[model samples]
Target: MSIADRVRVHSVETLSDNHYTLRRATFDFRRNDGRWQRQVRESFDRGDAAAILLFDPDRRTVVLVRQFRFPAFSNGHDALLLEVPAGMLDAAAPAARIRTEVEEETGFRVSGVEPVFQAFSSPGAVTERVHCFVGRYRPADRHGPGGGHAAEGEDIEVLEPSIEDALAMLRDGGIRDSKTIMLLQHAALHLFPGAVATPGK
Candidate 1:
């Protein structure tokens, strides 16, 4: 049976609506044995986001950002995370939002961004899908010092790491953010083309 035929939504209760949203949902799942099971789940609804990996083919480098994440800190991980330039969609198209985010977070105006794929960051409890892209950039494209928006409480530090170093970081767990790791590995596989082995191969 299709997913729609296998599940039913009973109700959703809004738990919060500050910056994002939180909801508690009641639903019914049809089991493999044709039995119905009622379930209650809480989900965080932070809208969708877009992320981009900015690479310079000639230089073999990628631009990234570092910033403090309160959630990670609260969960016993390093608060400062190194990740691809990303931001919420906030009513903007995925491609358009990524362009603005790249410039705002990394000081690079990139064109001809190639869409990769969309993936859910946390399918279990968070309702956020990240639209991913890869784009070519050059040093001349840097137009501003990107430190993120002060009014929005962003103190992002822009970073340009060589492709080799980035791959090493991924192998050594230095780069722990999932989206960033995916983008970097994608660059290694497709953008760089045979420069590195596929992970686990």
Candidate 2:
């Protein structure tokens, strides 16, 4: 039987609809042993987002952004989180949205974006599938000093670090954001192979 046939949703209650929708779902699932089990779970429908790692192959550097994340700070992570340029789709195409986001957050206007993959950042609690991509940029592509929209309260700091240094940041826990880590790893393996030695086996 398909997954739709294997489970049934009893109800979904909207707990909150402020910034994003938060809902509690109650459902029944058919177990592997033929028993039916009922479960309740809460998930945040924060909308899907797209992210891109802007890289300059010639400069061997990648563009990143640093911004304060309230959730992280509330959880005791007091540092401005470093991440790839990303934003909510808001009905826009993933590719188009990310291209705009990169330009807005990093000041780089990237044209050709190579999609890497899509994945649920937190499937158990958040219904947000992040569309990831890697795009090439050049120093000439920077047209503005991107600090994000002040009206939206996005005070972003842009960073351009070498691919090697980014990998080291990944290893040393400086780059804790999941999307950034994934794209950097993709760069390490595919885009800039042999740029840096892999960790000890």
Candidate 3:
């Protein structure tokens, strides 16, 4: 049976809603064994987001950014994390949102973006789906010094690393952002074939 057919929501309680949103929901779930059980789950919803992997095919490089994330820092990652340009949609379409994010976070205003896929970063507790894409740019495409919005307290530093080095960072535990990892892997497989090899090959 489908999830909607097998479950019923009892009540939803707001746990927190100041910054993002956190809610506790109680529901009745029917198991495959034909038993119904009461369950309580908390969900964190911060809205959907969009991320783009900006690449320079001729240069074989990818544009990235380094920024401080409180969650990552609280989880023992104290240093700034490296990741592709990404931002919350906040009502904009995925492709349009990502295009703005790429320029805002990397200073490279890409003319177009080829969408790849969309995925949830953490499904168990977070209700967030990220739209992903791959866009191309050259040195001349950079029009501004991107450091994110000062009003939002975003302090971002741009980085340009070769595709080989980026994948290597994926192997070496340097790149930890989930969206960034997914985008880079997609590029390796489709954008630039043979960019990544089979493990232990």
Q: TM-score winner among the candidates?
A: 2
lDDT of 3 at 93: 94
Per-residue lDDT tens digits of candidate 2, residues 1-201?
Answer: 357887999999999999899999999999989899999999999999999988888989999899999998999888999999999999999999998988888788878998899989999999999999998888999999998998998999999988998888888888899999899989999999887733531
Better of 2 and 3 by TM-score: 2
> Which residue pairs clash within candidate 2?
none
Q: What C-alpha lDDT does candidate 1 achieve relative to the native structure?
A: 0.90
Once fitted onto the true fold, the runs of candidate 1 whose alpha carbons sit more than 4 angstroms away are: 197-201
> Compared with the true structure, what per-residue lDDT tens digits does model 3 show for residues 1-201?
357988899999999989999999999998989899999999999999999998888898888899999989999997899999999999999999888888888788887899889999899999999988998899999999999998999999999988888898888888899999899999898887788632432
TM-score of each: 0.93, 0.95, 0.93
TM-score of candidate 3 against the unseen true structure: 0.93
Question: How many backbone clashes can be found in candidate 1?
Answer: 0
Instruction: Rank all candidate structures by their lDDT, best first, as comma-separated numbers.
Output: 2, 1, 3
Q: Which residue ranges in model 2 land beyond 4 Å of their true spot?
A: 197-201
lDDT of 1 by residue, 19-110 (tens): 88999999999998999999999999999999999999999889989999888888887658889999999999999999999999888998
- Residue 96 miss distance in model 1 (angstroms): 0.2
